[model samples]
Target: MEMNLDSVKVVGFDADDTLWVNETYFRETEERFAELLESFETKNKIDQELFKVEMQNLDLYGYGVKGFILSMIECALQLSNHTISNDTLQEILDVGKKMIAHPVELLSGVEEVLQKLENKYRLIVLTKGDLLDQERKLEKSGLSKYFHHVEVLSEKKEENYQNLLEHLEIDVNEFLMVGNSLKSDVIPILNIGAKAVHVPFHTTWAHELVSKEKEKSTNGYLKLESIKDILDYLKH
Candidate 1:
């Protein structure tokens, strides 16, 4: 891992898997969704189709549980050829409601790391999702007080990050982003001359996967087994 934390002033954390348990809930809900629509299609087929539906709807619904629920509904309709009953649709809606109401489970060592770095560097959340949903999670997390700012972005592209850095009055090299997804959290920030640390989550969304070749070419960023380990890299 090659890193120069000497210039880093603002340390931005990714909210989802980096700091808490998020993708697991989505995976569990997906399994339930597959079971619900088993009569229409096989679990494998349903899973693949749900991903396709999500990709197609990304532009329309953006990212979050609400968009996920809508994608599930669309997938159910298509797989059933529009024959899926209203009751099933209600069940899908309930799944989303339950997810939205799910408690915020912070990953291990999250607080300890935050406490160690809170005063040393400016901490901010750089996550992408529905604004309301993100805010709700932040409130439930009880980690909001440690952060200097919270940004719920619609997308995690180079331009979005550029704008954020500009607004914060920080140079690209002075900002470091920590997150789970390389495609979303690492690559874009790296592209804009910022530093990024990849803290891998066991279960990643398919959309967040990057090609091996692409990953190999994107050097200079640190890849740690856990978010807690970031303290070792920056604290030294």
Candidate 2:
């Protein structure tokens, strides 16, 4: 479907994966988590069960490292029938601490893209995660100056985007969302009559993966190779 940028005024960006390294850390942590539980279950089984736990806890813990750590702890206890060692539990907590402490690594040309668009349009961050953790990353990113607003959403859905636009007083057709997840970032905005740009990251969470059929049916979005390409698309 063709997208018209002529009406666009406000640009929203997704935090993890889209602007910086995020999902890769989760994948790495899952590997470590699987290893921690290897004695009770195979690596593959542990991985599957962990995913199940995360999905089940989405409402309770929401998203981010804290929720992931809790899910890992719960999975470990279940896999071991409540016999998992305290040391292993501590190790699981350490895994989350390490992830939380990791420095924010911005994607290539992220700052440049933000700089290019900063003055031309109102820019904001529309991301879902632990509020404190998302705020910490934004502070560390040093790109906070580029955004007029930063919203840490509990979830990303059509209604969430609609409310955000209303809160910001932006017309649906005049807002463009840029992010890496088709499920969270692209599809919802498209469904709400807003434009979206899909800047894909190499590593995606299993939960965010949409079926090929679902992807094919989505419209009113553009797919670009990198965040930097957004400058070319929107700067004309």
Candidate 3:
């Protein structure tokens, strides 16, 4: 990985989970959502149905707390056969609002890693979600000063990375993406001929899970236990 990243000039970081806590909130919300509909169905069933609704509405709503809230509402309506009370519905909205209003929790060693790499590399944030929400989080994180650019992508496929890199005038060979999700951060960046470092978070959303075979096939990307470990490879 060090050999591959020796030429890297720009480092793209994934915002949620990589730099700070994110999926844990969604998990907590899911538990609350399940409880809200517990009388209608088992918690397991509610979780499955809500996930299905979210997947069904993915293209329509994209990824973010807003879409998740809508999915939960839809699931509640379906699970309760349209008999869901207005008060319960309001509670769902409040839960999502709370997630949005939740404070940013930076991961361990995140600031230290960013600070060390800031002068050596052009740091940028490339994340996918609601633009306004992402920007709001970045502002609250107070780590935005270290980045040269911040992009809120609707998706993180190869083309998205390719286009953004091209627009930013960064060569793929000279770029390194560091993030938590292998599906979003590592795999796509590796596929695009760029270098990537996988810094796994304790919790990952189901949509971001990759198969073991898929993980094994991908070569050249480094998987580290902590973000701070990257300094050993990238630091001069």
Candidate 4:
């Protein structure tokens, strides 16, 4: 674990899993959704079809409800042969939207750590999703008060991070990105010469999974089993 508190001033977090439980709710909703499609298509087929559309919608719709809605729409039309009624589609849409307003709970020690770090570090939240949904979740979580800035990103690419670093007036290496999802939060930032601390979540999201690990990174990349481990890393 490589960390130097002096080298970092702005600590940006990848919301969702880092600050609160996000994937568990998404998983529960997806399980029920998968059940709904079982009669129309096999689980394997349904997953395959949905993933195909999600790949295309990544840029067009982005993450959160918009992407989930597009995925469900594509899934319904594919499974139902373009015959699925609007009512059923609406139900899925409702579910996707509802996910945002769902009660957001912090993983154990998240509030404590944030409270401890906020006084010393300029903490900000960097999340990719529907802006409104992200804000609502942050507000509902009661953790919004602690952050100095909140960036709701459309995508988590190398450029998005580079732009953020420039806009925030900070060097890539000066910012420490703490979050889950190696593909989104770790890899791209590392590409830009930034330091990233990966806090692995217990329940990872389906879309967030990179499904592969590539070559080793030259940038400092530290991985932790849980968010609480962050305290130890920061203390040193």
Candidate 5:
């Protein structure tokens, strides 16, 4: 679908995989988690069980490393039939700690795009996760200077986007969101009468994935090969 770039005034960027390396750490942690449970179950089964527990605990823990750490521990207990050792459990917690301490690695062209667009548009950050964790990453990223506002929503539904736009006093038609997840970044923004740009990361968390049919049905958003490609249309 064609984008009305001329009408775009405010640009919202998603944190995590869109601007920096995020999912890679999660994937690595998952691998470590599976390895810790290999004695109790196969890697595949461990992965599935962990994901199941994570989904079940979504509302209880929301999202981010803390929840994921808890889910991994719960999954280990379930897979091992409560026989998992304390050492293995400690390893699982360490996995999450490492993830939290990991340095932010910005994606290719992230700084260049932000630098070019900083003066031309009112840039903001719109991401959902543990508020402290997200804020910490933003501070570490050194990209905070470019953003006029940063919001860490509990969820990224249409209403969430609508409410944020209203709170910020930004017209829906004049706001454009750019991010890596179609589910979190593109679809909701489109549904809320705003524009979005989808620049997919190589690895997506299972929860952030949208069905092929849903993706195909969604329209009115731009899909770019890289965040840098956005410049061609946004004209920063």
Candidate 6:
């Protein structure tokens, strides 16, 4: 599906892997905890515990730093010899406050592409996470100016995307969804009849890397290697 650039009024972007480095920080924290718990449990066992806790918490807690914090606590308890108190749990949870990743480095030409397209499209950042944390990363990366609005939500389902477009009084066909995850970003937008662009990120979030791309839902979706490729497609 090709688009006339000027006709596209709203361009929604996903956070995390799409705009900056997200999963690496969580991976780093998990590795640190594995080392700390290595004596109590084998590395394989620790990884298994983390995966189980995280899977369980995704249902109870949804996704974000809070879920990650809970996963760490669960891992600690499952492998610990002594009883864990609330204070001990708080100690584990507090790590999230300092869990900010290194810096925001764009995937190749993300910033440049955003800069080029900002004037033509109504740029909106639709990301999910702790609001303050997302804001800090955006500010630190010097990427806040290009966007007109920033929305941080818990999930990016069909209802959420549809509501945003309805409120903006924009037709679904006139808007586009651009992001990394084929699950969260591509499939849902397409389900809503909006144009979806799949920009693959190198290191995706563990839960967000979907294995269902071949399904009929995303058959005609536009897939690009990176954000920069969107520019070339646009000029066509």
Whole-model Cα lDDT of every candidate shown, in order:
0.93, 0.92, 0.93, 0.81, 0.92, 0.78
Candidate 1 lDDT by residue in tens digits, 124-185: 99998999999999999999989999999989999999998899898897899999999999
**Total backbone clashes of model 1?**
0
**Model 4 regions lying over 4 Å from their true place:** 211-219
| Model 5 per-residue lDDT tens digits across residues 1-236 | 56669999999999989999999999989888888888888999888888999999999999898998999988988999999999888888888999999999989999999999998999999998999999999999999999999999999999999988999999998999999999999998988888999999999999999999998898888999899999988867
**Among all windows of ten consecutive residues in candidate 4, which has the lowest summed lDDT?**
211-220
Better of 2 and 4 by lDDT: 2
TM-score, per-candidate, Cα-based:
0.97, 0.97, 0.98, 0.90, 0.98, 0.86
Better of 1 and 4 by lDDT: 1
Please identify which of the two predictions, 4 or 5, would achieve the higher TM-score against the true structure: 5
User: Which residue pairs show backbone clashes in model 2?
Assistant: none
Candidate 4 per-residue lDDT, tens place, 5-101, comes to: 4677778998888888887887777776777777788887777777788877877888886677778878788889988878788888888878766
Show pairs that collide, candidate 4: none
- In model 1, pairs of residues that clash are none
Model 1 lDDT at residue 81: 100
**Reference-based lDDT, residue 204, model 3:** 90
Candidate with the larger lDDT of 2 and 5: 2
- Worst 10-residue lDDT window for candidate 6 reads 211-220
Show the lowest summed lDDT stretch of 10 residues, model 1: 227-236
Stretches of candidate 5 off by over 4 Å are none
**Candidate achieving higher lDDT, 2 or 6:** 2
TM-score of 1: 0.97
